[model samples]
Target chain A: MRTILILKRLITVFYYLIFIGLIAQLFRIINQIITGKIHDLKPKIFGEQLDYGTMSLFEIGLSGVVPVVLFYCFFQSLIYLKRSLKDLESGNYFSALVITNFKKIGILFLVCSLGEVIGKLLFFIVFKSKFHFELDSSVVLFFIMGLFFMFLSEVFQKARRLQQENELTI
Target chain B: MLAKREMKSKELAEIIGITTANLSILKSGKAKAVRFSTLEAICKALDCQPSDILEYKED
Candidate 1:
């Protein structure tokens, strides 16, 4: 239960980071567009950017889709975990939601990580063809964080098994 | 000869990985079976042998 709460809180932070990262970029754009010279504020795709800033349809479309899928999968995992914890605390062990949704979350995280990697590679290809943007280390860093969660899920599963065995003996 | 080593199940359980409730079940022999790992952990925690645990009844 405590572990679930920790995970739940972390998910909130995770989503917040995602929102902040994306919105910061948009705000930068907003600041540029608002400056007195709107004519000089033509949409520009810098070669050094790793984003959906100013790009052709196919590239931007792929970038746009990844974040949507990542968010969808992440929120779905969070909701499942929340419901699972609520059910358990209300004394519904038979319907332990975490155990049920654990595997699905693992799968989604894997997919999300893959999407991130692919998006990074795509950005590297498209943008570097114009100008050089240093690859962001934060991408791999977050993916490592995802792996840490995956490892934790395994530990939770083991702990659950031990708990169940103890209960059965009683 | 049962040289007794006295300890409450709860006390033993706190020291061990298993719960007091589980220890109670084991002590009463109501437990269906004990896994070797759990058994080892219990024995180690209690500082005793299986013979210290299992009672002998001569029929």
Candidate 2:
């Protein structure tokens, strides 16, 4: 019980941190765009700095939109996970809401991972840059953890059914 | 019947291998259905006929 409380508190803290970090990143990106710092940052393409002015409006729009969408999805997934943990802490492990949230988190993680890969590919093509792709461990971990929670939700569903049967047995 | 037979609910529950809560569920008529095995156990513990303890009424 104490461990659960501590974990809940820790997750809450992490949730706040992630929220703040996302906001900070958003501000930073906005500042960069407004101040024309993005153009000066020297984003490399084919071993040379690509001038942002040369990029089309569509490419720039996509670059900005993709990061924001990825962050939103990742943050929302964490929010769902935190809520599920809160349900568990309250001894509502077998709740349908928890299961739904878990499934949502799983799907969001999968989407984030796939979106990251596709977004990078699009960026590479648009910039005519060195094609760089690497399997990110954190994204993989999140995806696996999401799947595990989804599996746990199913187990909880079965356990809840058995509990009901036991209650009705006599 | 239990009152007339001077039997305690606790003792009956112990003999029938069920909890007092389950016994209460039965007494309250909240149970959806009763299994034959449980009905048999209850009948044996109470020393009564199934008919003596059960009745049907139209909803």
Candidate 3:
């Protein structure tokens, strides 16, 4: 229990850090757009520097959609994670709601990771750029962590059923 | 009946092989269900018939 409490606190701190990081990213993107930096598509692509430019407005718009969707999914997973941690802190370890939230977080992480891969493929096709495709370690880690949480959710569901049975047993 | 039989709750619980807390649950009518084995143990410990102790009431 003490370990869970400490872990919950650590997760809370990490959540705040991620939230701040996301805000900084948003601000940086806004600054870049305001300074016309977005017009030059020479930015980093899949962790590799690409010198491609001369993209159509529609292509740029489509490229922007991927990152936005990725961020939305990531943030949503974080929300579910926070809720699950809160439920744990409240001593509702076997709660069905917590299990549902864990499953949601897991699915969202999977969506984000898959979305990144698909987005990279779409970017390569639409932009007609010679980009090296390398799998991101962080995205892979997220995918594995998502699977772990999904497994944990199943374990919790079983434990919840046992708890209910114990409570009802005379 | 325990007072008439000179048996404490602890004694009854010990005879029935259950904790006092669980016996209290049965006594308080908070138990969801009781097994026949446990019911028989309780009846044997108290020296009573099932009809003497068990009563059904609708929720």
Residue runs of model 2 more than 4 Å from their true location after superposition: A29-54, A129-132, B1-41, B44-46, B49-59
Cα lDDT tens digits, model 3, A1-170, are 89878988887898899889989878986887798786665666555455436666676676668878988898888778777887898898999889999888888888888888888877776666656465889879888988988998899999998888778677
List ranges where model 1 is wrong by over 4 Å.
Answer: A1-60, A87-96, A127-137, B1-31, B34-59
Provide the lDDT at A144 for model 1. Answer: 67
lDDT (10s digit) by residue, model 2, range A16-115: 9988887886797689889977655444432345566766757666556766788789889888878888778988777888878877887888788788
Q: Could you give the interface RMSD of each candidate, to one decimal?
A: 3.2, 1.7, 1.5
Q: Work out the iRMS of candidate 2.
A: 1.7
The residue-by-residue lDDT of candidate 1 on B17-42, one tens digit each, is 67777777876776766788777776
- Give the clashing residue pairs of candidate 1, or none: A47-A131
Ten-residue region with minimum lDDT total, candidate 3 chain B: B26-35
The per-model DockQ list reads 0.19, 0.48, 0.52
Error of 3 at A49 (Å): 3.9
TM-score per prediction, in order, is 0.45, 0.70, 0.71
Query: Best-fitting candidate, measured by lDDT?
Result: 3
Candidate 3, residue A4: the lDDT equals: 78
Q: Write the per-residue lDDT of candidate 3 for residues B1-59, one digit (tens) a residue.
A: 78889999999999999999998988889887888988999889889998877889998
The candidates, ranked best first by lDDT, are: 3, 2, 1
Q: Which is the winner by TM-score between candidate 1 and candidate 2?
A: 2
Quote the positional error of residue B54 for candidate 2 in Å. 7.4
Chain A TM-scores, per candidate, are: 0.52, 0.78, 0.80
> The CA-based lDDT of model 2 is what?
0.78
Clashing pairs in 3: none
